[model samples]
Target: MSETARPAGRVDTNMAHPARRYNYWLGGKDNFAADRASGDQVAAVFPTVRRAARENRAFLQRAVGFLAREAGIRQFLDIGTGLPTVDNTHDVAQRIAPQSRIVYVDNDPLVMAHARALLTSSAEGASVYIERDLRDPGSILEAPELHATLDLRQPVGLTLLAILHFVRDFEDPYGVVARLVDAMPSGSYVVMSHGTYDGVPAETVTKLEEANAASGGLSRPRSRTEFTRFLDGLELVEPGVVPIGDWRPSPGTRPPEPADICMYGAVARIP
Candidate 1:
């Protein structure tokens, strides 16, 4: 693909796309029949799948809020940003710090069509969308759109949610993460959520894996060891790597033990 030949404009609704399928699970309207069918198939096999998706979104909102309000982070680079849902990273961050600048990167065609929804930002902050592949970290970092929106000199929150799993061992997911983190300044944060089989029943994991395979989208359920490897050099926040619902959940809403959700969430600060 050429520098300008982004995978935007046309959306393939005939097949299930990761972002759109995720949107379907999140109860969003941007998905097509194929996405709904695939998502329903997975949800049927794993009844808690929808719950896990919502919990992950809640975690995203809370995490971004903390990064903006407490950590004083003013910029964000959200990779593999799925379909624009309620309270997107920019929304949560800019709500706390209006001047916060956010740049969202995703290669999904539906996400690209819905980029407009992601681009809306408060007057106090700035937002932009870039349709790019995270596998090419060099291109992602060097993209003019990214460079123009984010200040590399400042601490940035790099978000990779439900993404890295698509990149198998051959793709060197760890190295891809390292490339992005290495490019950021100290005090920066690496916030991530990964799907795993460590908590759920083997049958559920197998079913979801089969559905993802049939959809033609890459999906891999990593071990806790593999997930922690992504945060290799950073200082993990309190409570360490835990299930999404268990990551510093707010009052009144008690978190279920890690077994309830197959997704793991953790935030790490670059020292």
Candidate 2:
């Protein structure tokens, strides 16, 4: 196992980390009472929060499959990878192409606690975990684990699933993404899903913000314009930038009635 796969410090169950809180919402057992409480509060106001999360996860699965099986992408750099849920990026990609490589990144310590098995790789492929902050995309791009696992000269599927909100106003989220994309080769793909305020009531947005603030303290949710700005120079895949459920849902996968599909998703190829 790579040194980055080990848990850093002891897990802190006292504070509600976003990754664990999200896991709690998805009905996973990796979260604490604090996370459950926070998650419950968020769900109370916006009942579709859970559905949105699930849809986002489904989008990830489909996107990774498309990358590995269709786009022939063999390496994945999955940033903001929350808890180890079923059908993780590596699992989906490697299942299709056993030689696929994946590197999961997140700053949350709880994810690190579960990082052991996540770092396991197929004999034909490789997997690694890195506990790096998204704010410093340069650090993530420069990490030894990432450098060793991915080849910058080739196409890589960079999935920023449900994570851009954690980047506040001062963080230069666009520049952060731009830096990461700029370092990769042209054929690389950028998969993004961000929490947005589109179609949601103003007060509901306010309440959700307040709830998030109670724990993580005010994660800035972006607008459609802001979210699209991330793909400024890239070529967007069919269905353009739309709600998470709007992005190429497989047959039989019903779209959620647009209550709180308060998130937008898209896949764009780096030019």
Candidate 3:
């Protein structure tokens, strides 16, 4: 499908979209010049950002591996599904269990343009994409594409990695998480990774914030205490919420310094 055919309106290459900027950070070529500029600005303040992005993707693969291989989760609702990269949730899950079903949600037209990459599933599995915003959990939960691909009655691995930080306090991010978690069955899982200003130097945080603000972006890094509220009623898995790199790192993988990661990741069971 062409960019102009997206129902979300025409794609604006001039604007620095978070997904496109993130694509630039991850070394993907689908982003425009505006996205590269925004990504460069953020990287200038936090030189480890590119490393953090790669580490975050590795964290996602590990988390999904655990969910699919160990936890036996066959359904996934990956909201804020950014530009496709290696080992996406469906790829990881379907690799372990070929029958896995996944529904990806995102509002970015650029992401939608690359939906084909995310939609490729094994013969025994299924994948679908929904052009929706994270601010509306009700709509995401009610989306026909989601319901059609995934059975809400079964356990679902809900992933919100590196996306909630964009959902500011006014949007009640905690409430949004609660709504999605509430919709899942008892055995459902919530896998998340959120950016934090905790260990970073104050000056670096300030510069990053200023750059994001100048680009018409919003990023609110929460404290460990504040971040925990999003998984309030769920039962946390092993090594509960910790720095992304520290969360079940694969053997021989040298985790970056906690100060450099600047993100917290965790998996929980909705009992």
Query: TM-score for each prediction?
Result: 0.94, 0.94, 0.95
Model 3 TM-score, all chains together? 0.95
Candidate 3 residue lDDT tens string, 1-271: 2344235646789889878888888889989998899899988998889888988899999999999999999999999889998888888999899999998888887797698654598899998887878999887887767777888888999999999999999999988998999899999999999999998888888898899898886688899999988988889999999999999999998888988889999999999
Evaluate residue 240 in candidate 1 and report its C-alpha lDDT on the 0 to 100 scale: 88
Scored by CA lDDT, what does every candidate get?
0.86, 0.86, 0.88
**Candidate 2 residue-wise lDDT, 172-226, digit = tens:** 9988999988998999999999888778888987888788878877367788999
Better of 1 and 3 by TM-score: 3
Give the runs in model 1 whose Cα sits over 4 Å from its true position.
1-5
Higher-lDDT candidate of 2 and 3: 3
What TM-score number comes out for model 1?
0.94
Model 3 ranges with Cα > 4 A deviation: 1-7
Ranking by TM-score: 3, 1, 2
Separately for all candidates shown, the number of backbone clashes (residues 3 or more apart, or on different chains) is 1, 1, 0
Better of 1 and 3 by lDDT: 3
Judged by whole-model lDDT over C-alpha atoms, candidate 2 comes out at 0.86
